[model samples]
Target: PAPPGEGPSLERFTLAEDELRTVRLRVPEGTSGTELAALCDDLALHDWLLTTVVRMLDGLRLGAGAAQDAGTVVRTLRPAVDHLLHLWMPGARVGRELAALWDPLEERPGFTRQWQVLVQRIRDQLTLHAVPAVHREVDPAPGPPAVLPRE
Candidate 1:
């Protein structure tokens, strides 16, 4: 449970269309149930990766998009990261991997380089997990057609 008086934690970063495209490219398609289960496990790892990166970015006062005060950002994001890791990777190999990544971060003076490294790692993993190529329907019209659907 969180300490009294603290606000709700930050949600994990949302995947944008580009990010989803990257993920689709990495994870193979037509995966069986067992493989899907394994991918779920991998997703846990990926979540932790994102959480850690966000934590570091928060500490540096780098907003996801908008600007925010440094202390407030850290306060909100640190707990969020802790909660996310606890939920996703509790008593598992994901915990070990996070610890390994976090150890160096603890000793680092500034977060800029570390943040870049984390982002690159995530991108690489997303690429690796991308689904195999599949045909996509291309609508000839870029915008809505002149006709409208009947009620």
Candidate 2:
């Protein structure tokens, strides 16, 4: 049941070069406080994760001649990998009805898609950083000799 003239709605906006974002959700009249709180918490966590990752990326010079050192990149992004990456179970605790609230966000901004892309970028950076080390480790030893049997 909607309240008075109010109905379910989700209005989202961004400001400050995507550094600031807001989501206003109007749930049905009978929606429980617990449900609302859970939804808000989930949304807030994701917002923080998105903002933090964006900030981290902005601070990096991935392609510039003065690009960040590999160690610096790892140091900057390690917290996200260790702490935030595993926390993205959106709407997991919300009711089925309320969980549907995430649909619009997913469709328009494609939250999960953006997240996946960002995560991949982080992985690619780390992989690129590791290439030299991997090559060094895999260098053949001086005494490597193998006998080939005739097929």
Best by lDDT: 2
Clash-forming residue pairs, model 1 = 24-130, 24-131, 25-130, 26-127, 26-128, 26-129, 26-130, 27-129, 27-130, 27-131
List per-prediction Cα lDDT, in the order shown. Answer: 0.41, 0.78
Model 2 per-residue lDDT at 112: 83
Model 2, backbone clash pairs (residues 3+ apart or across chains), number: 0
TM-score list, all predictions: 0.28, 0.81
Q: Candidate 1: global Cα-lDDT?
A: 0.41
Off by over 4 Å in 2: 1-7, 13-20, 143-145, 148-151
Candidate 1 structure quality by residue, lDDT tens digits, 63-112: 25555543444455555445543343322433321223322223442233
* Residue pairs with backbone overlap in model 2: none
lDDT of 2 at 4: 65
Candidate 2 at 5: error in angstroms? Answer: 12
